[model samples]
Target: MTRDRVPHILILGGGYVGMYTALGLQKKLRRGQARITVVDPRSYMTYQPFLPEASAGALEPRHVVVPLRRVLRKCDVITGRITSIAHGDKAVTIEPEAGEPYQLEYDILVVALGSIPRTLPIPGLADNGIGFKQVEEAIALRNHVLDRLDIAASTTDEDVRRRALTFVFVGGGFAGAEALGELENMAQYARRYYPQIGAKDMRWVLVDAADRILPEVGDEMGVYTVEELSKRGIEIRLKTFLESCVDGHVVLSKGKPFDADTIVWTAGVKANPVLADSDLPIDDRGRVSCAATMRVAGLDDAWAAGDNAAVPDLTDDDPDALCAPNAQHAVRQAKLLAKNIAATLNGGQPKEYRHKYVGSVASLGLYKGVAHVYGVKVKGFPAWFMHRTYHMSKMPTFNRKARVLVDWTMALLFRREVVTLGRMRMPREEFRRAATPKRSQRDGSN
Candidate 1:
């Protein structure tokens, strides 16, 4: 390498860690210190915390995502997948969406590929179960739920109506609970528009293998979450597994098999398995082993964090404890990671990453929530308000923050929009139907 050549820093993902790290680096580094390049499959970074509200029509989907090219003006953004990484050669194979794979060399590599859904081999789950991770999934779930209401309202068959109105959510974690809370609230509100469907007609059930839900919040808050959902006529099933959902026939371990039209899977996530192919040191959970400094263990030029890396939890007494996979930790780690990289490039020492756990807050519905922060507990409206206030402040750009604020203000002034563009799923269906000829035309009767 020539002394005149600037160092190329490659970021593997444009998620919470990747995007924020680039944002920080672009600000912290000198004008000619390093050239930054961020590679991600999608062009935008999603604010996952706001996904539930967006799904429930309280916010727009586009507002929750920040376009990578627009935000990272100083960085070269590549919409491609990192197929393989050969750190020994300081290069990675990139697979663009429409082209053949190619190799890209860099002086430093940042792995923030994040995690994917941890799924099980339950019968019909692969065919029928829908996950609640990406914005697309959230939008699809909203459309499906509303479409079911339409079906139940129009159907005359009692069994069919019952099945159409039944919505089942598996996994009592943050995603499942929040999604269920918001969507159930939206569904209940939408019911008023349909005179045929009563409050009792629609069924909302939450199933979890563990005995508790929303464990991120506190024990008391978790219990309160269950009770609150119960008050809304939503059933909570704990210490139970989804034995099967063959053809929408939900069979639980301890209950009579019931048929549901919609099934949502929010069961945890696992680290990306591609890290192993890079020959990086990984923990048993498939996460890259990262030091307190957010650098890959035993490697100088490689860095990793977020859900894809097992970062030491310095705030914990347990030596083996790792940071929790959440937006709070990811955002903080990304900022530190950028500074650390810049410090190393400029012959300065990189600092360690450490932070004490503050607590947690979750939105149950519009004005309903639970929060446990700094040893203080708050429930209902106060908690809900805190959830919005805290996340909105943490939300990425001022542009997004203002857009989200406007969305909330408008929502308070008007009723929620209950329209479902379910056709977005299969957009070509209407076109295909319109282009197809009728039997009379086919037979030349007209």
Candidate 2:
């Protein structure tokens, strides 16, 4: 398509798909062959699996993120949200963080915009609920959890103390389960320093509409996770959902009611709403429809992957099945998508992306986990080791891997940092107040 100037490759959403796809292209394509431009709201890609550890203070929050521009030296990274795409004209409307919307022309388009948190219409949810998808939310939850401990230890009102100590999480997938486990583990350690509060003073509850937790690892492992969490005095509510969280009073579908200061929402995710405005083929669930080769169905120049794409699963014998949205598939799909794109660009035949499902591993806490690989099942320390080793190997870049290892090593040599920096959230409060004259001073001076 390039008669004179170089081809422009516009990649949407600098997440797992965008970042890895760009890396693959940089390695495969020749200089000036394709000018890659990545558009995302954030400048970095977050390693979501490590979010639980970051929230628990097991790893520094900054260590779990990869700077997009720093890694993709050959590509132009634009921190913005993609408004719409006109694939017919090979153009897109990009809304930058601090500028007017502009049209971006591209010969090749990669829609990796990814998914957003799927929220239900529940009372008071907007006022009290927090999500677990991003690094900021994880850090806020960490500080909020510790600050709750501080509140419980200092308060004399029984109701206030009880409310502050109660932590409620609504979901039982990898995100919810691991988050509850890690934070509970950290809270147990932090409780040691509080003379007024004991381990029994805190209440951790996990609720899910599904019958089992960690469904990716199969039934046996899921049951084992429930049992292990039960032994830690964590309450698991299956076949239930949150009805309301009005004014911090949570009401369950089972008719249980309780006052809670903390509410973490990790129910699930849906494709980014921006896709609804595009001309691409989207399925009923709002995911981009892609062929086995990861190219957008019926579109020669467009491709999609990750949580936002419904790619037919060739690995599954069932003809009706589509690839489950997860990091394992997303990472692998990014590579193949890039390869297929490159193949088409070079006038070569594109290959289909197919791989059997690799098994799942999840960390429960510092020295606890559950894993199922191939046909083998492991729990306790062995599973924990597998969890750490697998993620450490999968985490992008040698620099991040080294930093994560150092963080673990330091944790082993010393106690975990249990302090909360809640003040960081409102850093300008003191300054703002100091700048304002006192009421008495204002009157006397006048």
Candidate 3:
């Protein structure tokens, strides 16, 4: 039971809430009073809302992610996945690459391990579908889409070309809709270089189980978004689910089977599965249960927030109402949680987390978008402008902000980069083939 000289705070996950919460703690606490450590699988925090634009060549991939090491200089950053949380012992088990499981004790723990892609047991999903959650996934998807176009342009087989040109996106939320829109826009522009392939030749389908898309925005704006996307020849399939996607052959609940080389899954997200392994109190959805103050119920010096924690929504009267898992709530919750943690450590009363839902904005390709900001509805170019402006203001650090702005500026003057390096996804495949021994000595031996 030997204790470290300085009190340690272990923050899990380097997402929107985790990074900001650690930053707040470092800035508030004295240099020597407390030590902070952040553990996440990624070495950087991705500003996820900018992912669509980044995938479409509107923003640099690097600019959309903030390096955890460079940003959190005051805190210890561990690049590893948190396997389990031992709340009773105030410790966490981390599994880093090429290492034995190690436990790290903390006086305070912030469970900010964010949500993962909510996947279903639908046939062929695991084999054929790719998620749009991480930076690597985004980059891979961009390259894959462009590479598909290249394949289609060079191939003479109609079936192969059709499959390559056809792109299917499941989930019509912000992630699915925006990604489909931006990539479609980029692919359309790319078709100009290929004399054979035109925008009409490419098929883009967006499928969602919900009746309405972009539920974050109001119904009016959602309708406007659907209209704009439909006008661009992008098919929107509502109240539909992907029944199966076996070997790229997709069968929807309401449509005929179609083969697509690119299938992106962005339907929704659920809390991290790690929560279920811990002794901490969790809700029915496998999210850690926490009060409005962001403290895990019946736990001492432990708090949870972000997508993984089901924080009670004080603003809503429904007993079952919980904060929606979004960046808006995560950012606000992080600030409050940081202050609360700091206060608890310094013998002060912690504050409760509360914030009004402002609104949402979604970019629908180049100059099209839909937004509902503070009950004021905006559509078309105005909404698009607002989407960019809002995200630019929220993007982490001045460096990333400047880099993203520069990316946009260059995009305006130059053609979007359409080149794709699909081989990057499996860079070692060639080596694997080359290393394999071939049968050669049969002439003399046989």
Candidate 4:
């Protein structure tokens, strides 16, 4: 592609980094200063922090995601997957939802394609384990869990009831812990509707390979989290791994084998594999290697950030330290990236990225949480409030922020939405069944 006075900026992913970068650039750059284009498989950006609560029905799923076309109105929005990036030619191949693969040329490149769930080669995990990284997955897991409760309440067999009531989550990080906590709280509230299933009948388990969970929240809060979850009757299995889960029979490395219908996997994440196909400087972990200024190493006109880029952590003593792949860093990096891009366009030098690691916050259940921020430790109701307030503030747009706040307010006034819409998964099933003829009618005995 030939360069004009105004360059065509192509952003690869519509996630935290991609969305925020485009948003900032739209506000900073004037009309025709730069033509920004963002591409991703989804039409909206999911605010991942609220996923656990969304799954638990604390927030509406639609409110947690920001529509790309709506928010980035000034920028061109492309809904598709990045098949490959040929930086040598300044071109990218994209396969859209319904069309054949096509190519686009750009003068400036922005790579923000985020990470995927780090899954293992476990036998049954691929078939049974549900991922927790997407909004669709969150809703599916919610329906599946509630359906399991329905099965438990209606079943006559004890084994089936026990299997349906047992829910196992393999990972004790923020995703797993928060999901387990919020879901357990939701399930407990749902138990009031089921006369057959008591609070003691259900089993909730969290398994992690490491000796501790919520490592980012520090030792004291981590200990407190363990104790608090234990009080909720949720078993915390530390230093243990899943040996096998073939056919829904979960066999832990240190526990008795049991059958469970629901298995949620949230271990960790690795950089997007598509980076490997790109002609970019990448690290051993398949992440784009970048300088402290968020520019791709040794390359101009190419930039990377978020979970897919290995940006140096200047605040840490370790020279090789990379900023943790979380929204806290990703959002900040995207903002800086926009400014740097603008500066470079105006013949100004780019600044290096530097930020100290801040503490983390996690919600255990309704009105229960833990946090370690700015060297201060807090837990219980205050921690829960902080967790909500902090994330709400970070949530993009006043539209979503107001919706989530209203959801929380309505929750306090009434009750949390616990009813599951299982039909969403099989919208066509009912019509198909209705259209089918009965055996007697088919046999000419109508």
Residue lDDT tens for model 2, 111-184? 99889999999999989999999999999999999999999999899999999999999999999999999999
Query: lDDT of candidate 4 vs native?
Result: 0.93
Q: lDDT for model 1, on a 0 to 1 scale?
A: 0.93
Clashing residue pairs in candidate 1 (N, C-alpha, C atoms within 3 angstroms)? none
TM-score of each: 0.97, 0.97, 0.96, 0.97
What tens-digit string does per-residue lDDT give for candidate 1 at 1-446? 34349999999999999999999999998888889999998999999999999999999999999999999999999999888989999999999999799999999999999998999999999989998878888899999999999999898899999999999999999999999999999999999899999989889999999989999897899999999999999999999999999999999997899999999999999988678787888999999999999999999999998999999999999999999988889989999999999999989988889988898999999999999999999999999999999999999999999999999999989999999999887989989999988677666695
Candidate 4 worst ten-residue window by lDDT: 1-10
Candidate 1 C-alpha error for residue 422, in Å: 0.7
Q: Give the per-residue lDDT digits (tens) of candidate 3, residues 342-378.
A: 8887899888887878999999899988999999999
Give the clashing pairs for model 2. none
Tell me the spans in candidate 3 whose CA falls farther than 4 Å from its real position: 1-3, 428-446
Worst 10 residues of 1 by lDDT: 437-446
Could you tally the backbone clashes for each prediction? 0, 0, 0, 0
Q: Sort by TM-score, best first: what order? A: 2, 4, 1, 3
What is model 1's C-alpha RMSD?
A: 1.7
Instruction: Give candidate 2 regions above 4 Å deviation.
Output: 1-4, 441-445
lDDT (10s digit) by residue, model 4, range 1-446: 23355799999999999999999999988777889999999999999999999999999999999999999999999999998999999999999999699999999999999999999999899998999999999999999889999999998999999999999999999999999999999999999899889989999999999999999899999999999999989999999999889899999999689999999999999999999988899999989999999999999999999999999999999999999889899989999999999999889988999988778999998999999999999999999999999999999999999999999998899977778798788899989999988677655786
Q: In terms of TM-score, how similar is model 1 to the real structure?
A: 0.97
